[model samples]
Target chain A: MIVAEQKPFAEIAGFVADCNKILVAGCLGCVAVCLAGGEKETEILAAALRMHRRLQGKPLETVTYTATRQCDPEYVDAMADLVKDVDAVVSLACGVGVQYIAERYPDKWVVPALNTRFAGGSVAQGVWEERCGLCGECILHKTGGICPIIRCSKSLLNGPCGGSQYGKCEISKDVPCAWQLIYDRMKALGRLEWLLEYQPPKDWSKSRDGGPRKAVREDATI
Target chain B: MNLTTESRLEKLLKRGEFVVTAEIGPPQHASAHEIVHHARLLKGYVDATNITDCQTAVVRLSSFAAAVHILREGLEPIMQMTCRDRNRIAMQSDLLGAYSLGIRNLLCLTGDHQSFGNHPTAKNVHDLDSIQLINMVKRMRDDRVFACGEPIKEHEPRFFIGAAANPFADPFEFRVVRLEKKINAGAQFIQTQCIFDLERFSRFMEMVVERGLHERAYILAGLTPIKSIGAARYMQKNVPGMIVPEELVQRLRKAKDDGKNVADEGVDICVEFINKVRKIKGVAGVHIMAIAWEEIVPTIVQKAGLYPRPKAD
Candidate 1:
């Protein structure tokens, strides 16, 4: 899921301060699942904006709309009529959805109402934890399903560093040593020998180092 | 001022009867008008009214203003205060303001994080958590002084402070322990999150009673009727720590199949839930949250057989 945290109220207020006609768009995808950009959140943002506008004597003309998935072109097309009349669209979706709205309607201004955080899941009821780094690599099978890229402080591909003490990271007492976890998992699986296997450095060109990555399949394309 | 708020709460506590309370959501667009309307509708029917302060990370009319309006309408208002948006200084100032305005009851909470609220960019000032706020209130009441050691000649405002607990959210074993901590911090009452599992609540109560907390604190179970299958789904998915049991879903399904009024069915479900809750040992009361449907609260109270009581004095 594309996880995003809403920006502070004053920052959001300032972003759309110039627009008299505002469309507070919500995305019912990742942001909705995470309780960031959803129908309820959209209503909340609209109400707050209205109250702030009223307090400031601006008297904004605000309307709310939520697309099924703001990141997808098919779902974003649903907002064509809604976005046409509004002077600016304040998107409550993740960064992708905000950019999607901007791309879909080049004539109208699109502003992000949320600060996209990380791809994570709920660790507890209300607490979300970062899980994946989206570093354009998959090493879970070799690392016992734990992503070293995100969980590890150093993202070491080989083994536990000298700084690992008592299965804890050198950076903080709270963080469990990711390499230690990987070793323990490997030991449990009777594959401790895999840790000794030599692995080369990760290819940086395949990751964010490459400018604006894209994927296409000629056979799948309509 | 006819029915003293403390005496009324005390009467309910002493009787050990099933007390009923309702929520009053202030209008986002307008102020005193909606507050008074709901207050008048729910007056005398509910034991108290909870004036929510910007519930669900959304800004609304001030809870202080709504509480004052409820007071003028001859009803007790449980003023809901959050530690978000306000620093310790402003929180203390508001507490004093509410006290000076004759508002007595309080429900202290560590509000929704700024990330959850409408304005994401809003800087959250969580100077104190709910427990600390409760302790602060207790200190003000007992010592007649603020945390900064400012003294006043007059007695501090006597508030029946309450806090919230979610059994479904936290570990079951820790629920009672958390309650004990809140009670230790001087929480006179507790209004829990929405409870779908009465059996879980019963077990929680058993633990609470075993820990000897039943003697000191009044625990109120929260109940909000499900209007539709969609609403039920929404609550289960979005509301943090809220659990709507399978039985409730089945009841909603049955209501849908029977072609009965779904909204009325919702009230009937609430009535049934309240009846069951009232029978449970150590259960002090129930707080009904009829969000945006405050008018039906009186009907629910009447249906649940909690109406036509003498004015609490």
Candidate 2:
């Protein structure tokens, strides 16, 4: 999931400071799942902007619409009829969706209303935490399902370093040592021998270290 | 007569009969027709109509506006204000605005978390919890000044502030303590979360009596009729801290099996629940939350034998 948090109200106001006719776009994809850019949230932001603009004696003509998914050309094309009259479009989707809107509507300026954060699930009722780094690698089979790459502060692959104490990380007493959890899980599963095997260093080229990635199949193309 | 806050609460308590109250949900859209309709339905039958502000975190017409509409329709309104959307500054300003509009009764709540509501991206400003909001109202009533040291030259608001409690939400022992804390924070009355299990309510009332808070404030039990078997199941699983007893569910199921009208059976369940609550010694009244079924409130009140009695001093 591409998690994002809505920018502060003041910052949003500043972004649309010049535009009189603004289209506040919302995405019903990953951003909606995280409660960042859903239909309801789009309306609220529009209301707040209207109220703030009224208070400042600078009225604005704001229209809100939520595309099924902002990342796809079909969904972004659906909003073309609504975007004609607007001076600028404020995209409330993730970075990819924002870029897609900008690419599709090259004439109109597109502003991002959310800061895309890492992919994660809600830890508790109202809390969200990062879980994956999207490094384009899967090493869980060797680490007993615990990803030391993301969970460990140093992202150490070998084992627990001298910084680990009493199952806790040296960086913070509250943080559980990721390698310790990995060791305990492997020991329980009789897979402790996997840790002793010398593994090659991760290839960073497949990740963001290289340029933007794309996937295509010649047989599937029309 | 400009009655003091104390005098108003005292007058309600001294009357001693069941004080009926009804809820008014503010509209999400700009239209006030729905709010006015509910207010008109409950005008004379209820003592006060509660205007809920952005209930469950969805944006709605301001409670202050709803209260004004209620007052215009010649009914007292209990403005339900939650500390979810605004900071202390805005809350204080809105309170003064509500007072200026002649709204006297206030129900303070630490609103439902924004995650549960439709607007997930909306930032929640829990500047002050419910207890602190109650205290702020009390301060404004007494000193006629806000936390920011702003003086009110206008007539001071004599607000009969109320709070909410969920006896079924917490352990039995903690319910009493929570009620006591609310009372200490200057809550003149309390409307509990929906009550399905009367036996538990009786035990809760017993605890209130043990703490000597039964006499200090009016405790209004909340009761909502279960419209269908699906609704009964939904309440048990989804609604936090709500316990719909097996007997009531079984009764509704039986009603369904008999091929009788389900809504009428739901009303019968509500009537029975109200009667059970009335027999409990410490329950001052019952707040019937018939969600979107405002038309049936009068019927429920009439069935519960809670017609507006002559105020006895």
**Weakest lDDT window of 10 consecutive positions for candidate 2 chain B:** B1-10
CAPRI verdict on model 2?
incorrect
What does the lDDT come to for candidate 2?
0.79
**Considering only N, C-alpha and C atoms within 3 Å, which residue pairs clash in candidate 1?**
A6-B120, A7-B120, A7-B121, A8-B120, A8-B121, A8-B122, A9-B121, A9-B122
Listed models, DockQ each: 0.02, 0.02
lDDT of 2 by residue, B1-313 (tens): 3335633333665567578788878888888898888888886677777788887778889999988998898777888988778767798888878887788889988676565578977766655656667777887888886755587676766688899877775334445665676777778889988889888888888889987998888899898987888898887766655788888888888887999878889999899988888888788888888876888898888887777634424
TM-score of each: 0.59, 0.59
Off by over 4 Å in 2: A1-222, B1-3, B6-10, B149-154, B309-313
Question: What would the per-residue lDDT of candidate 1 be over residues B11-101, giving only the tens digit for each residue?
Answer: 6666665688889888887658888888888878888899999986688989998898899998888899987767567888898899888
Model 2: clashing residue pairs? Answer: none
